[model samples]
Target: MSWIRSWKRLGLFALLGLVLSWAISCGSGTPPSTTGQQPSGKQEVEFWTMQLQPQFTDYFNQLIATFEKENPTLKVRWVDVPWADMERKILTAVSAKTAPDVVNLNPNFASQLAERNAWLNLDEKVTPEVRQLYLPNIWQANTLDGKSFGLPWYLTTRIAIYNTDLLKQAGVSKPPATYAELAQAAKQIKAKTGKYAFFVTFVPEDSGEVLESFVQMGVQLVNAEGKAAFNTPQGKAAFQYWVDLYKNGLLPKEALTEGHRYAIDLYQRGDTAILASGAEFLNTIATNAPTIAKVSASAPQITGETGKKNVAVMDLVIPKDTDVPDAALKFALFVTNDANQLSFAKAANVLPSTVKALQDSYFQTAPVNATPVEKARIVSAKQMQSAEVLIPAMKNMKQLQKSIYDNLQAAMLGQKTVDQAIADAAQEWDSRQ
Candidate 1:
């Protein structure tokens, strides 16, 4: 959830890629027989990858070469865009009728474009065989208002990573499995060891995790008419859980304003005992605090009543106007195929969205000489069986999140009562509708 801000910053750019067919026409005409040459008048399909340059240039180049060889009549011009400039570049290209045929983007950004009818619906273009390749929940990430607009790419699921040494110091033999157990452990750890038991993050920018915690507790966020529905008993209990932790000094005071990075930094420096985060973060622990890495262990992500997990996914989408829709989709499928996905996952230490790729031994088997990082990968991949995007997609999702967190902050700071906070948040959400 903390990572969402980066993508949302680019979301406004979705409006940039509008219909350009009226301004200029696609290149289409003659035929060529050369192995790598497009027919003399064929339009080159543009492919854009986000911030994958410098490190992944070679990998992408090799894949592009192979693809061109197989489809000699089609030419794909690959472009690497910086993360900060992706929205601008894509939007500008679209406005000028120079948008890429295929582009790599996140679900949230794709959702924005889909809402504007600026993308091609894969359900109408791709075959059933191709549709069956991805994990069902992940494939749904690209669907906005019942239309599939993107293909699943790489993803990561968060899990509980704890300091075994710190737990041992507090006489905690195993990590807590439930919220109640976690609170009790925090109390015991603070009383015995004087170290913070948990970093209960409350930063407004990353408050979605707290919202997700409530969802895990069975709090429906919105009613059928899109009105706020979380001002209920379950919501009160969820908010009170954190309120109790903060007031009793069981949680880090910095948590009142900190984000995941701060919590991770505390764990790396041996100031905290637990961290609920993505498996990829283990690599940072390995690099920044080798000492903490030695005593670190991973477990399936902690959840509430349902025992499900949350995931962050990346996807590839096609703009509405493209000279080679079929050829573009063919290349998108090729890039996300099992073999290619597996190769990329291995190289990047990420999880693949394709079921076959996930079933591969690389994700299924634990290494004999496993380190904390390896342990995290195995645990995370296993948890993916029950994982899904934590927050449901909505046209006003960002606005809803801000409304909830603002009210939550007021309550946490004693500016309002829990009931009043929920009421206020619900009112704000309703007004937005």
Candidate 2:
């Protein structure tokens, strides 16, 4: 009986010891039991960016590498897709619940995404310190319904880049300051130099930039109700202005088929005397055709009717599914901060989106062709302060822009009269609405 009791006591003591050991292990912060198995390594985050191939590929890769080096515990993988297919791919990924952990997108889509609750509300993530890094205007542009969706990574604006040699050849000493002056100059240049003086890449059916030109001319495309209001008297007048230019032989017929890229190429190749485009063209010229580097750029002339300068904006946005929202927002803030903005601006020949960066010493310094770039930058900065946002009709904006330009092109080719083209375009715009 004594031996049996001893064995029972020994068994009870062993059980207590085991229980204590298990408790201690838990208290020591041993890995908790997960449903399946423990992950082998640190968390990996997938990031997607709009097509950043050959030109910006290295810069972006280095930036990501630096981010990983600074964050040893986090791994970031990148996916690059071309701009044309980006929206479609991203939407597909979102639908499949396979969206990237971080995404960079344009601001125009940010509002739509926000409306659909497809983007993270960055207001909670971005600190006041982070907000101060970008220009107020850009920050506002990315904000929809009082919430910020993304940061402005880089920015570009349209400026009138003209062929200085052509201007000299035409005996025009100065660039046009107003639309009327521009028209008069265009007439004189065409008459004397036998070259198109102005090119409008406005295609009513597909050219968003052409619509932007109308907006710059103070033609409101939509009212408070978001209905298409571009067929108003002011809109008609703006459309007529383009028709007049086409009829007078001041603009090329090719402009109807030419989008922004085509117009920039024409000016770069010295086929046209003037082009309204972003500073990215500067780098394009430097890389593609070194000889045309002598061409200069100036502020896009204000129209005689509206006296308003037009500037288009591009911005950055965060998608809804970013896992490390805080860290992603911080990185965005870091990149757009004044110093990083300067770095990007210099690398891309794009204007800085922040006030501090724009006023930096680098931008103030005159380039080889100082006058035009400086003038354009100053005017663009001012215009950006009051730029209007374009919200197209509910259906077929691309078709509408194409139709307007197709008719105008016909007019330029002498296949239709200016009145006929304008009337037909108006009818088409009305029918589309």
Candidate 3:
């Protein structure tokens, strides 16, 4: 059975590699290098980004134009890749020595890339003044082992998105503040409205999103020694908490396979009364399903186990072998600067990663939509200072994350008791090492 599983995993990865290779072969050409002594005249830099389409195109273009006007001799060529294909494409480009001058990446992936020595250290490029402009926590996320490889582009944090109409029907006067209150409220919402209390998509291979919250609840997935520790007392309790919620029918069984989009859809259709997601969901709800926009965003209730709130950050980084390191750094700073940060915040509803941008008039006094962006912005900003960083085990995080979540899914589905599932996960983690 183990051998069969290994073969299946290898096959899946092989298929992904083939698909990535095919995509890279069709691209226009290799991304140009902008480093190694500035060109005598025009220095053209290639900037690659993930699908920042219709909403962010104008703002990004404007920022580029302004930067070019100021720099005069430097020119930037922007290439956009869809998010679905981003990881595969970027890795292929890097391996083929055809990578972009600069690239934007999520913080979670940034750390992994840095571990492989794939990103350039930006410590020397950023001046004290430039560093001061960004939020302290945002800057910290971009640094790994004393090297700064990326800049914080935009920030996001999860919040409790509740259906106001459903709450009213349930006779709940307000959102819950404690985990106990939240569970009770969920039960009440379901009894009165015949809808699930909360929607969370938990899958074995895709557990990072939900695991982030569990970590915030004081469940340590890894110990200080960087060893897998999710089978500990804290971790077991956190797993049991979710399992109980599932057994009580307060959560949907589909959560085992659902993704963020699916949960958002359930919230929009009023099939679920609460969702734990980022601010982007507000824009999505408003645009895709207007009725759901009527819901309100509030701070997520604390876990009874730990009173601390959890926020996960997505960071942007520059790869080490980037051809135009200077140009890449400049562009990274430009995009994350105060002016452009506000533009991105307004258009994408993402919290700005810079302190000044977050304090700007647009974010400070932005008008309330039915699902006010302010709620998320305020909560994220307040929590940013103390938010826990996402630090999975560096050595075998991919395997460890998969093992922990596979057992978690089993517990959630009643296939195994929480203790049994956790014990199994620990055994798997040890064997893999």
Candidate 4:
């Protein structure tokens, strides 16, 4: 989930409960040298990203050069923002009418601002033919009330990273492909290895993996009126599923408080058998735990009956009040065009959101001698055909996450019954409305 972006930038996905943003907060690192504008008298299209600098410096430096060469009248000033500082800083900048012309943000982070009409309407600017360049499902993730606010950028889809040793110890030849199989495997792993099969933090403020699970299990989170729709039998079953796991001790105790980072640590240390994370994390695993990396393997992420998968996207948006809408829009499109996106994806080891870019042979094929990381990339890219943002962007997304997570935690802690928890969560969600 963090690029490791919420999943690689590792900031956004690691934070996906926080890394894998969708964990798309700002970071506190040094930016690329491609900063500071000159008095060249060219209209500057200021660009901001969530800590993509230092690492992608050369790629961006070349990107800016190409965009400037293409649009000679418009100069580009790239500013890389920290993960935690982006929201506050950008909010302040937007308030002061000094927001960047093209900014990087995810759906969840920008939904509230979208409700306030703080962003430009891409539907009015991006032509129908141009809009088709992106995956329709991914493009819809950036829309609210039928208006597009951002251009689809890079994406990360969770994959099942498993420790083969752990699974072999538990006598399982294949990783669990469904929740039923996962539950069974969880029990087996714990019984045999005395280690949890997986770690999913129950902290209401944690990643939305559990909430996304509810959807995968065929639980509708909202109705046509936006009221809670998760108090049904399916919701109760989903709640009980986790409660049973916690109570049965199939999950790590730290799950109640820890987050995605902890989950990754556990997996890397061989304490948890599986990690629902982005493929780019394989690189981190190879570096931080080389021994474990040798035995690590990837499977398609575990799913419920619906067979749905979660995707995190980092998009490029423009402020409605910017003086250079055309310039900003042109730069945004240029940066996200097929060729540019493929280059960035290769350099960064993430997936592209564009239909054409994703079709590139790099993402579509893997050599026979591909390492685990390379194979994981091929699997993740192939999965792009079916993956989507399970939890959509809405003004109340955080609240929804909080309500469900809080009630689920209560159930896990024995403070509430499964039915009571489901009903209360629905009630809490409705009360807020």
Candidate 5:
């Protein structure tokens, strides 16, 4: 579900409309009209989601049908938006007061609108008993400034996918479980097999894995006051760690500009020994690179000494100005309830944010005849017990990424010392705050 953040589906016909729609959508954005109501007097609420069309269309249509059957007076209009266009579409839609009643978005983008009070404050809307339905940490992700703006939906956590052949070539019996072990294996794999141990982009705007790594390494991103906190001794060490990795040629050169896709390419091409990504990728590798898939095995994500892991959450947010706030919350809760979440998690190959849904036997235990993908699912689901959104959702999150990454790159290229890079990145963030 979180992959939609980086996934772009086909379209330029839509791209042309993007610029125009962006402007109009932001112009006092219009909320869905009441005009769509049928003669039966059922109130209609619109739901918007990132690119999940075609593949999940049938699933959702049935879900909506089922919901409507239960709530006879409420009708839902499902809008499936392309992934790349979400930001512009939402911005335009929200500003015009025409935003959907309930929308699916990640905290990274949703936080921006939340700061403007564009989304309803769920703390007041949902009862305390209702709040107890979700995993505490997952629910915590939707809160900003002590107010909840959304309810957690689907989740994703990465697991280590390693090539056994490559490990054998490097004389390593097991894939590394910690960053320290990963660093050592990187060198051994490089020397023995002439392959990188893994691929993680250094590109400022790409995957947030590297940034999450810093936190896993015990570097606080921002302090209690919400100012930059990554300039401490721990932060300097984290910066230097990446610098050394790049300078020593352990990371691929393309990492400087490439994104997670490139990491997948390298892993599939057998140029990297491991791929840290969603468990669903095991099925992908099995199809794309059967040879590699045959020898691949799943392990826990490479963590720092702290053993922290990162989780990606897709949330359900209701616009503050929506005409059907109560209806929206009810539908959202229905969509995310344990039964619905379990069904979607199974259909979508993602983890569920609902506590009971996650405790289902499907997630808790792999069958005796489980395939690699099945076992990986358990590994991913298990991480939910500890994984969380490492980067705190905030306004201008991309700016924070850019600052730290640009500085870190400079240090790697010998343009700045590690200390200077960390200091500069911290100052830039504080200035913005």
Candidate 6:
């Protein structure tokens, strides 16, 4: 279970080579510091963030300068890597023992490295007080085998963005609050307005969404022993729900193959009634479809038997072999503290992971001149109260997601029964163990 072994098995070796070439041709592109102060006996620590340069160059440069000033014995060199190159670059670096002291990563990639023990267990490095600063579920997302490996940084959660005018036209006064209601509204909206209610894409890119829906419906997914438990009656019912949606024309014909961008396009063009999306997309709507933005209203994303919603989080992790582990953890804490996180959030229009940052009146109170984008942020912040990672992080997560998605596609396209699909997916997951 070496870091390189699982990644190589997943066909990432060629990508790793490319990352090495790029790293050699162009060094990490470390930003120049404004201050010329050099500290004596300073341990040079590399800190990497995924594609956050140029836009936040000034902000990070200042932060790095301040951090260096404060920690006279530690020097942090900031590296901004492209998002597409992160996984390969990170694997290559860690394997070669040239990994950064602190690196920014999403939960899945961080979990993959954590599973192989490539990251330091932060539960030992950070105090309970520091851990308590973040939302419990978000903090829990970075834990594996009862040990925490990363600190929650920033997050985004899906909210149900729907055309209020369309709901009104269909005689529905409110957006759907639950999965059943979402499906019912879809049926009514289609029957009354003749526009599709929502697009249910089952392509590889959207498998996580499908998994989230199933979990929302009370599917256990993985059992207590970590084997697939989604073959149960509840799982079948969840699968059947989508099959029924497709069979009855509640979903678009391209649902089997399309991706989120296509779904967004449909919603923007008023071809769909509802679009489950992150708050950032509200700006896209306003820019691309002014008319639709005028009619768009958002609600906390729909839930099911359980009321939890899905969230995607970015976090900071310390490499297990870092020479300056203490300095790295301290610098990571400095960057993610309430003030810094809030500053970054305001700049990026993303949500902060720190509880105090989230509780700041800025998030609690909506802007006076609220546009759809502003409204989305206010609503999304509220939605964060119950948000958690939808697809539980696990080793071999990609395989598990694909297994469930492929079977779901077969069931949706009428190639297999719901029961058969669930059984086959469960079997595949079990075989992986």
- Give me the candidate number with maximum lDDT: 5
How high is each candidate's TM-score?
Answer: 0.89, 0.76, 0.84, 0.92, 0.93, 0.90
After superposition, the stretches of candidate 1 with alpha carbons farther than 4 Å from their true spots are 1-42, 95-97
* Model 1 agreement with the true structure over 145-220: per-residue lDDT tens digits: 7899999987766678899999999999899877878889999899988998767566666536777777777788
lDDT of 6: 0.78
Candidate 4 least-lDDT 10 residues: 15-24
- Over 262-342, each residue of candidate 4 has an lDDT whose tens digit, in order, gives 887898888889988878788888988999899999999898999888788889999998888898898999999999989
Off by over 4 Å in 4: 1-39
| Tens-place lDDT digits, model 6, residues 69-128 | 987777888777765578888888887777888898877888988888999999788889
Q: Residue 218 deviation, candidate 5, in Å?
A: 0.5
The TM-score that candidate 5 achieves is 0.93
At residue 232, what lDDT does model 2 achieve?
Answer: 62
Error of 6 at 316 (Å): 0.2
Better of 1 and 3 by lDDT: 1
Please give, for residues 1-433, the per-residue lDDT of candidate 5 as tens digits: 4222332210111111110022223344344445235678887888887766656779999999999999999999887665556787789878888888899888878888999999999999899988998999889888899999999998877789999999999998899998889999999999999999998887776677888899899999888888998999889989988899999999998889888778878989899999987777777788899998998989988899778888878889999988888888889999999999999889878889988999999998999989999999999989998988888878777788889999999999999999899989989988998
**Runs in model 5 lying further than 4 Å from the true structure:** 2-39
After superposing candidate 3 on the true structure, give the runs of residues whose Cα lies further than 4 Å from its correct spot.
Answer: 1-40, 295-314, 366-371, 374-380, 391-396
- What would the per-residue lDDT of candidate 2 be over residues 24-106, giving only the tens digit for each residue? 22232222222111164555566666544445668767877887788766666666554445566667766655666666665
C-alpha-based local distance difference test score of model 2: 0.59
Cα displacement (angstroms), candidate 1, residue 305, comes to: 0.9
TM-score of 1: 0.89
Candidate 3, residue 167: the lDDT equals 84
Q: Residue 143, candidate 2: how far off, in angstroms?
A: 3.2
As for model 5, its CA RMSD to the true structure in angstroms is 4.3
